[model samples]
Target: MNLRQKIATGAITLCSSTLVLFLGTWEGNGQNTVYADKLARGLPTVCKGITKHTSPDPVVVGDYWSDERCAEVEHLVIEKGQLALADCLTNQAIEQNTFDALTSHGHNFGMPSTCASRAVGLINAGRIADGCRALAKAPDGSPVWSYVTDAQGKKKFVPGLYARRLKEAELCAK
Candidate 1:
């Protein structure tokens, strides 16, 4: 289901396609089919970024998860990530797009890292738009997180990540 579709999960209202679609589209949106990661983190992933490590059931490279299972797992994982991200936020009541964008960013990055990010710090300081922009670039014209270690133990600039951060920043600014 896309973001246009809403389904109830446990207690999280994360069924909106806005967040799900934003994340799912970037996740290289899949259903039951398990495949390799698009980036260098070669984990076997399924559904909307549900890796074998994140799922309740053991997932191998060739695993075939059910759609119901994928949705359930994705919702649960997203809910957990969002909740964790929310806790790191400040007194500001964030907008839906802000929440979605930050949540997705936290999901891709780590919530702990997101919590300690300059973006979160700016958001805490009531600089929402500035905070959103911080995710894409620092004041010195550099990305906050556009590098990933390659198999050769070298940092590689992931254009996809940089693009996604810009998109997230755009969503947040709106």
Candidate 2:
């Protein structure tokens, strides 16, 4: 075969080999029809459990935790009619620079902007509001602040403002 044809053949063979191996492994067990379920749920499974070898970003334990934390709070507000998510997230904001830290850690989705927006959307769409208002305030009576200070010592807290997605949306509407 020509060089190009040989390369194509090799690529196809490698992909099929990987697929066959995956089909025989834990994820591919006949229990849930893994491939079918992935397709149905819109879950990405092109690389299965394989990491950098295939997809550049592989889901990790930390990713799951972030998702779980967010989901748990959302669920509590939406399903249980509980306001604890606000308190839980209040502590989360103060203890962790959650939004910025998550962004710096290459976790864009974990940022409060996105999560807060989603939470609010859920609330507006018949789910509970989840009390994101409380999250924007620091425990020490100061608001959760964000802004750039000028060299002249001008501090701006954008008073009564929220750096959250849902709150931003709400404000924008008004």
Candidate 3:
């Protein structure tokens, strides 16, 4: 059965308990602090996650994500991440660490790409090791390689994404 069907039929249960487990497994590890610092250092622009260039709640000059906002956004990230996994992962059981790592990757990259990713395919095919390895490498033309124009018109790759991907990969391996 499909995920929604499974949920509806009580074959699969996704609830606050699952969310709590996910939250406990996926620590932010001060990612918000790094994100905020990167934003402040760059040109004034608003971003929801790593890739979103614009957001409804735009962070302007002299603005930073408040502690409450940070928490709220992180919660949203985890929720979205879990939803993505639910839709794509066929495996009934997944390692908590793997789930956490994939959640972080999905949070940054979004559902569409994560859903279509080689990592997801391998994981769904029960090739967990291959999937984790595939996830560790950023493919060509990935947003991680995209450039942002600075005030001087010089374009540079977004800060922190590379490191973040590395961390995600490390987490995936565990």
Candidate 4:
């Protein structure tokens, strides 16, 4: 391999590692605290938002996790999420806030859906603020990522999701 190609490969590796780390520390956003599932989804989350979906161990509702345990699980989940999004994330740069925002969104929704979101498109297009805003609301000011369709065949606004999206948008714009 040529020197330039080697350098480029090294740079890409560095960037990918940085992108995987995202906010550096998940606790910076105060999301590391254990949270009981309010939706009765039976998925209580802890450090870096580790839930049953991402946890290797069974995530029980009443289980207590130490800070060390939480951090370990958090790193594991982050790695998993980044791998899941490997092809979806472009070769462009993603700022810390943008990384945090999108990952949180993906955890709440699904990683695949988050990849398909318009926010990802705008972000890849370098319209970062627009992309972040799109996570919370559309141009028409209606909620974008805050509703869930229920078994009753109706869409309902979830206050928790709404708040989380708003927070993500705010952080993403920073």
Top of the candidates by TM-score: 1
Residue-wise lDDT of candidate 2 within 1-174, one digit each (tens)? Answer: 432233344421212332223223422322211122221223333212222222334423323323334333323222221121222232221211222221211111223453354333443343332323323333354455333354465765543223432233232222
Q: Pairs clashing in candidate 1?
A: 3-17
For residue 47, give model 2's deviation from the true position in Å: 31
Worst 10 residues of 3 by lDDT: 45-54
Q: lDDT of all the models against the reference? A: 0.76, 0.29, 0.56, 0.67
Stretches of model 2 off by over 4 angstroms after superposition:
1-135, 159-174
lDDT of 3 by residue, 1-174 (tens): 655465556564433354334333433433333233343345343223422332435555545665566556556555655666777888654565666667666655566777788888888888877677667564452544234456676778754555565566566667
* lDDT, model 1, position 122: 90
- Estimate, for each residue in 1-174, the C-alpha lDDT of model 4 and write its tens digit: 332233346532322343334444432334545566545343576655667777897776566777678767767776567556545766356655566577777866778898999888888777888889999998898888888676676778887677778878987788
Clashing pairs in 3: none
Q: Give the Cα error of residue 84 in candidate 4, in Å.
A: 3.2
Report the error of model 3 at residue 66, Å: 2.0
Error of 4 at 65 (Å): 2.1
Model 1: worst 10 consecutive residues (lDDT sum): 2-11
* Total clashing pairs for each candidate: 1, 0, 0, 0
The pairs that clash in candidate 2 are none
Give each model a TM-score.
0.86, 0.20, 0.57, 0.70
lDDT tens string, model 1, 1-174? Answer: 222222132222554579888987787566577877747478787887777555677767777887788888888888777777766776354666777888878777777988898988998788898889998999897986888887888888988889999999999889
User: Candidate 3 at residue 22, lDDT?
Assistant: 39
CA shift at 88, candidate 4, in angstroms? 1.3
Candidate 1: count of backbone clashes, pairs at least 3 residues apart or interchain: 1
